[model samples]
Target: MTETVFQEESEVESLLSPLRSFLKCSTPKEWVEEAKKEKNLPTLLRDHLICELKAAQSAMLLIRRYAVDEESGKALLNWLKPYEDFTYRLVGDWRKLADYSSFNKRMVPKSRRPYSQPLIDKMVLLIKEELHHFYQVLEIAEELGIKYDKITSSRYARSLLSHVRTYEPAALIDKLICGAYIEARSCERFAAVAPHLTAKLSTFYYSLLRSEARHYQDYLALAREISDNDISERIAYFGEIEKELIQSSDDDFKFHSGLPC
Candidate 1:
């Protein structure tokens, strides 16, 4: 296990190299110490599972609103039903969650735009990956005897969403930038906490770094492609907000919450 772990870490170093350069911020060390405690593992897992499902759902929203035809929209709904029912309704157990898989990739009409297809394709990939991650998290939680529980959301995402512009194209651009920051921060946090976890959990977290890294890049790329003006200012503004959210005091020790108070 020791030798295998070393090789895995070595392989991910190339992935992490660019990850370090992509973000303007880091996860606070205080949060890491709080997250690494044995008592907090269950809370972390529960929050993470919610985060994964939310990521997939958010992507689904983007595709349905801007890209999919009516039939494809219905298909997307069917795809999400089992995952949502399990997470929100408590209608299914861990075994059922583990069994649920696959998302229909059928192409249909998109809200007309030159960049529409690229947006649809990237978001579909992200949604599929995020949902798969949700299942993986559930499996890990089951193995650790951690049951899913409803959690009040952290201010992290809402704060960012609250700042989104209220106009067309601009609104969409801001949303994509927000998505990028969220994915980048999640990747950063996973790397931050991995070393402090049990070897098994650590391996899982590190394994996520690559996909998370790419998700952020995909979002940023789309944002750039769709925008008519320079978005660097907006990105900088949100980066500052995201950094504050990460560094601020919070009573909750959620997966993406601020410094534990």
Candidate 2:
């Protein structure tokens, strides 16, 4: 490898190390092997496109539910409308989506909630980046001659979310921690599969590492900020759940799926 290549690899490892330690386990070799297969590329990209949109939608929900005022919430919905239409209704030109990823609306946080601004700030940026990534994944799929098709979601996110507490504040905090695990796992999988993909795809995946790493941190920081008490025990509790979900066998094999059975 050239000096530049070596330096890039070094940077990639530097980014992944803390993520590896943050999660209870790495992506299983079996899942990586399955994800890198040629037959799985279309499925992988399709699921990835949806995952990106879902991540954006999830962040949008956080802003709407916990922080933003009514008009801001409506603006957030409008911001995502085109992307949602394309994903669910198949009603728009995917090529035109790049222009829609931005949101210029002024978001007013709910009064008297000190944490509202930070929550809105982090999730709004996350929503933008995730929507942009959704477009990029679509662009890559088009470049590869892979047509977009809807696929059933993996059980991963639902299962993690099933454990969320039902009460206020605690529920929100749990969801944020869940967000952290989800983002961390996504970053880990991107690194695990990048090396096995085509050069162009590898480069794209590698480019996402920094943003994804920061996203997980953002989620964790917000979780800490929102809670009055220490959440270390809760963080560890979810880590074990996330680890099991990654290591267990599954018939389904989407982007965030567990080991392929």
Candidate 3:
């Protein structure tokens, strides 16, 4: 291989190293093999589109619930309305979604919490990028003649979130750590499946590595920032749960699904 190609591969490994260490296990080979099949491409892409929107929505919720005032919360909702309409209500032109990705409202923090601004800043940028990725996935789906159909969400996220503590900052911190695991797994699986896909698709998945890597870090950093005490124990606690979710048997075979049963 040329030096340029070798360098790119090295860079991708460097980016993924921390994510691999953060999670307890890599995605099973069985899952990757299933995901890369031609017959599974539509399901894969459809689920991916929803996953992107969900990621954006998750970040939006963090901001609206913990940081933004009433008006800014409304603005955040408006920013995502078109995408939600298209995805859930099936009521808008997906092609026009780019218009809605921009958020211009000044977000007034709800309180003097030191973590609020960092949370808002990181999550807002994450929301915009995820929504843009949603659009990119849609474009690829359209090119491949993959129609948008509502697919059931994988149990992955809900299951991880099921373990969240039902309290104040602890609840938020757990959710953030769950978010980190989710993002990290997504990045790991993207690299795992990229090589088996078409050149265009492989390149597209590779293109997402940097931003996805940053996203998990952002979630982890925010979690650490919000916690008064060390969060290492909590991070390890969730890591084992996330690892089981990835390595266990599952009948469903969406992007983040476990080994096919």
Candidate 4:
């Protein structure tokens, strides 16, 4: 009905086309039946809010660890200051007000950790997308009267980050690829959960949000761009790792877990 729908349809069809051929069965009938329920909205929204925060935190850690120098790390931290304050310190309404979200001062000296053109561009895109998602979650939380509470990091993020390499470019590329897995999985889950949510939230999740999809692709592209050879091995490497993390049980359930734990 909307351009967003058309775009998502095309992208999803392209991305999932290969997987579709392996599927002999359609979506389970139980899912369609459950889609008619009403309470799925608030329940999913609560999980989504936590997921949004975890996503942003994931990107933040990657950039802070690998993408920047000391000064740039401070700058990145400064960039996330308001969000950290809001989420941890309990700031004002972010939906109606963007207090300090300008990226005009993105400073990275050319001499220090000179980023490849593609890597810089893709990381910038991811940074933007993650921050925007953070804002959207804050808005939804505000509207729904959900009290934001401070919780320790969830196991999902910890597990994903644990697989990231601990060197330089390898670390950077692997982290980016890991980010891709997370975004791709999130996109998949949003699609999976959307059909069962309420009309409004379902529309919101399915709306013309350009960034999340970009995030998945952007991270993957950066990984390939930096790799010396074909990226499939590493891609498959992380995919297996990510799938295991998502498909297993855990003590905590956040944005990027396998199943309900």
- Each model's TM-score? 0.93, 0.98, 0.98, 0.76
Q: How many residue pairs clash in each candidate?
A: 0, 0, 0, 1
- RMSD (CA, Å), candidate 3 to true, equals 0.8
Q: List the global CA lDDT of all models.
A: 0.85, 0.94, 0.93, 0.61
The digit string of per-residue lDDT tens for model 2 on 1-261 reads: 999999999999999999999999988899988987999999999999999999999999999999989999999999999998988888889999988877889999999899999999999999989998999999999999999877899999999999999998999999999999999999999999999999999999999999999999999999999899999999999999999999999999899999899
Q: Model 1: runs farther than 4 Å from truth?
A: 1-7
Please list the Cα RMSD from the true structure of every candidate, rounded to 1 decimal place: 2.0, 0.8, 0.8, 4.4
What is the per-residue lDDT of model 4 for residues 135-253, given as tens digits with 9 covering 90 to 100?
77667656767656665555665676788787767877877777776666566556666666656556666552345666777777777766777877777777667666755655554
Q: Residue 47 of model 3: what lDDT?
A: 94
How does residue 87 of candidate 2 score in lDDT? 88
lDDT of 1 by residue, 25-63 (tens): 678889999998999998899899889888988888888
The deviation in Å at residue 2 for candidate 1 is 9.9
Clashes of 4: 1
When summed lDDT is taken over every stretch of 10 residues in candidate 1, the lowest stretch is 96-105
lDDT of 2: 0.94
| Candidate 3 lDDT score at position 64 | 91
Model 3 lDDT, residue 9, Cα: 100
Q: Which portions of model 4 miss their true places by more than 4 Å?
A: 1-47, 64-70, 91-97, 112-114
Candidate 1, residue 157: how far the Cα is off, in Å? 0.8
| Tens digits of per-residue lDDT for model 3, 180-201 | 9989999998999999998989
